[model samples]
Target: MNMNEKRFEEAKSKIVGIQRNREGIGTLQEKTVHAVLKNYYAPDVATHEVSLHNYVADIYTGNEIIEIQNGNFYKIRTKLEVFLEEHPVTVVYPIPHTKWLIWIDETTGELSKKRKSPVTGSAYLAFKELYRIKPYLKNTNLKFCFPLMDVEEYRLLNGWSRDKKKGSCRYDRIPVALFDEVVIERREDYLQFLPYELPEEFTSADLAKSAKIPSQTANLVLNILHFMEVVERIGKSSRSYLYRIAKDLG
Candidate 1:
């Protein structure tokens, strides 16, 4: 092999070794679920692709498998379908917060900021696919790990882009499942950071317009923000009152 290829292999090996040593720190997809449980659930569990079986999932919460889906959802659907046929586990795969199909203005093969999600129509088919493997899933002591999950935590956590003025993701929650109560505890920060991508404050009107949601929904969001003192009515307009997110961190 050429010197460059050899060097590349050596680097890759080092990264793998590091991953093996620090199993808690997983990939970007796994990190998404880690963030989820860290935020909502108190007790959580996650695992990186530490070993090779059918394949290593990003995060496996004890209740189910939480995978941060980043690429072709169908390919993951296929792999997890096979794995579920063998192992006893509930699967949760999170779709990233990519643009909705309505926003896509580009050609099918072309990539864009407005890429559409492929899994929207057939989420239930994923469950039906499990039945096709029911024979395998029926094995009790056999550790039936059939069935996979398609979690959308990555989509939820997409607000952490460095370009944004705020809302950076914290890596505090990993390797665990968080109950819903945790979300209640941090609701304010949740909205402030909006761990997942949503309409940025700047685009509330445009997004509301595009989604075909009534301006009332936008007003509702603004009201919720106002209740939290995150925003307030600056004035009345043609439809709704103006508001802004609160600035106090405490």
Candidate 2:
């Protein structure tokens, strides 16, 4: 089998193992999203709910801490700070590049409809939440991992929704495939995410146009870049700030 196919099977196997182990649990199993990833990344090398520094980390490998944050990163801001003090911490955030939406009727145990979502996700979305943990990105002991995966989104009908699909409640997300892993180990590594077409120095408008992202997003991207010391504001282009990569960094 090819390398990608091998990795795909490996990831799928991990999820299957987690499911088999949690067969008879009454309450929820610490979010299926987190369990699957913890198995995939640190399969046999880590311990779960390991306590250290007065905080219980999701997974610890004696030397480093790995937190599978399937939701907002802001919630773990304070906890992350405590871990970063003495040990390296890796935050794994999986972004679904392609998703299949499965709607189920709450009244009956039946699948109503299964369709692909028109909207696809990218690594860029990670930046939206990264803005909240901007200060932590610069820590030498901190790292961010964005795993692009193909996921199945389960929705229930009993929830209220204004949208026609009635996506009132999200049951769970199952990661079926792993495409690529984006690891940010250093502040300079973030520069690789920038567009090749970008000028040496440019405004948020220029970045927005070239990157095909909203101006507001461009602003947030710049905000994090500035805080990380990757770029510095040289001047102002009317209302927008002009920036260039720092001389010594990246």
Candidate 3:
């Protein structure tokens, strides 16, 4: 690893170690966001790294950005509302009521527990907030997506050692697979070895630095990728998810 990467990982390990679950939510969210972008982004647009204080964003190519808020849905919406009004951009929010279920390998097919879905409450809020944005989306052309996950397929491939709380496997086998299956079109920027997009074993902090995306977004993107079949979470004493390209892509 490079000097900056090593330093960041060392520091982040201490932080993740200290707080574990409480602090992990942000990382999880960020990972998921990145995964989605990797799956959907187009190649022609030039991408760059973005970072703020303790947070990093995935590779961003365009001048305008649309941030999807799941954490503090209302608060994030409010912030985006103001920003979208001031800038020439489109901000999209996933509906909270859109339900997702987990699929387990066992015959019973147990689903992962969901906290709060955004499909219902957030849509109204997003609409109201969009009005505050000076009707930007009305006249502008942009890309916005809120795709659904086949939660059943992901829930079944659960590699218990993935994370402390057992999230989807974006870290190891899932993200890699998703890259080809879902995000293959946008893999140009992150493809280190042609097919691979992200680092194989990176700390939350390391990812935060490299992607220039927030830690929370990174975590979210990773989990979503896990659900998509590109990575796997390793269950262990110091639970950490491993990012990987699925060997089965053959």
Candidate 4:
């Protein structure tokens, strides 16, 4: 097997062993995705869930801290502020590159057929969460790790909509395999997100087309990139704003 595949399998094995021996203690009680990622990033049991300052780190490698956050960035703002003061921190966020949806009937305990989601995932989705913590992006010690994976999402048929899909609660996301990883540690690392076909000055719609992401996501991506000085607001193109890569970045 390839190195990444081998690493993923090893991580899964580690989590299984922990649950079997520890009786699902502490972070082991977390969902499969979080547990697997914690082990995948740092397999050493010694480094898993180390206490630093007043917060518990998901993984501390002595030199750096790795936090696996599967939810909103707002929750980790305080923890990050304290950690960033003394050590470099890399926040690992998982995105389902490919997702299959399975819905369970809460009353009958019956599961519906698994269906693939129409929307594909991308690293650009991170901008939504990153925007919440824009103030911290400038810190040299702050880094981001986005792991793209194939997943099976289990949800309950407990939504407000007619089909019961809207506003549904996700029961769990089981990671099937690791596809790839995107690590952003420096200002220059943001360059990979911009498409080569983009013009010197482009609108969010233009970026949306090039990046193949929704216009809303493109706007959020620009918001973060603009704050980082990776892109500058050059001018206005009608109702839309025109943006160009910062000359320094170019």
Return the top candidate by lDDT. 4
Over 4 Å off, model 2: 1-8, 17-28, 161-167
TM-score for each model = 0.25, 0.87, 0.29, 0.90
In angstroms, the error of model 3 at 109 is 15
72-113, model 3: which lDDT tens digit per residue?
444544444444443333333333233343333444434456
Per-residue lDDT over 1-250 for candidate 1, one digit per residue giving the tens place of the 0 to 100 score: 0113333334334333444323423344434333442222222233543233556655444434434332334555455665565454433322222213211112332212423445332122222333333333332312211112222221123244564214634322222111111111232532532223343343446425644455555544444445545554566445645444456632
User: How much lDDT does each candidate structure score?
Assistant: 0.35, 0.77, 0.36, 0.86
Instruction: Identify the leading candidate in terms of TM-score.
Output: 4
Model 1 lDDT at residue 51: 39
- RMSD in order of candidates: 17.8, 3.5, 19.9, 3.6
C-alpha RMSD of candidate 3: 19.9
Off by over 4 Å in 4: 1-3, 16-28
**What lDDT is reached at residue 38 by model 2?**
74
Which runs of model 3 end up more than 4 angstroms from their true locations? 1-34, 42-60, 94-100, 103-144, 152-250
lDDT of model 2 at residue 26?
A: 15
Clashing residue pairs found in predicted model 4? none
Residue 123 CA displacement from its true place in model 3, Å: 7.9
**lDDT at residue 161 of model 2 (Cα atoms):** 59
Per-residue error (Å), model 4, residue 42: 0.5
